[model samples]
Target: MRTNIIRDEHVTVSYDVVNGWTVVEVDGDVDLRTSPMIREAVIRLLGEGHRHFVLDLCFVPFMDSMGLGMVVAITKRIREHGGSLRITYTPGPIVRVFEISGLHATYQIYHSPEEATQRTPSPDGLADWPHSPSVKKGS
Candidate 1:
């Protein structure tokens, strides 16, 4: 069941808990105008004690630099709270933006939401392979 759903003029954000991971699905362009709403939704989830996160971005067709910054900020805050966040995106504008900005290597991105959850390493959903601090920082 969906825990929360937020609808704006340009965006739709919803989330569900699947196998200990909170799957946040975004539908709309993530730009300066819409990033705050998405960020707030995620912060609310984090406040609710949902530690594991998978940002499912297949429905998000466009994301500007502000959107990416919001993601980075969210990830940082999640880690500060001892939580973890990952991303899942289809091959499209969002993926292309990440690639072009070199943020793809900065994030553990999956091609599908199933893969995102399947690769979750623990009940708390923290994985060692990617950017987790427990892992070697830049190896």
Candidate 2:
């Protein structure tokens, strides 16, 4: 497995390939200030010929519209290249944004990184990811 790390004052991006999937783990707020780090990592991974991605946002407590937009853009690029993107470990506020923006159903979302990799995709090509066990049935 190959590993790469990028750190900024606001965010840190680290990734490695496991079982043919590139797992990018972010530790920080993914707002306008930090989206670039994530974007660069995704672009670098694409350049490296990775077709599957798992974005682990477990430690990201906040993500503004810019961050969400970057995620959407990356997803589009990956799909254009016949790749797949799975998002895991979203914080509550971030998850709410995704739900309110009607994006929860668009991306494959999972409670954990392990779940993200193991779940099978639904007919629509999105994984049937369940809510995090730590989160209650309804907020």
Instruction: State which candidate has the highest TM-score.
Output: 1
Judged by whole-model lDDT over C-alpha atoms, candidate 2 comes out at 0.73
| Each candidate's clash count | 0, 0
Cα lDDT for residue 94, candidate 2? 78
Q: RMSD of candidate 1 to the true fold? A: 3.9
lDDT of 1 by residue, 1-139 (tens): 8754788789999888887788999989999998988888888888889778889898998999999988888887677667777788887788789888877766767777777776454543344423433322112
Pairs with steric clashes in candidate 1 = none
* RMSD of candidate 2 to true structure, Å: 5.4
Residue-level error in angstroms, candidate 2, position 21:
1.3
lDDT of 2 by residue, 24-136 (tens): 99999998888977888898888888778888888889988998899988877776667767788756887887888877766667777776666433222323222222322
| TM-score, one value per model | 0.85, 0.81
Worst 10 residues of 2 by lDDT: 130-139
User: What are the root-mean-square deviations of the candidates from the true structure over C-alphas?
Assistant: 3.9, 5.4
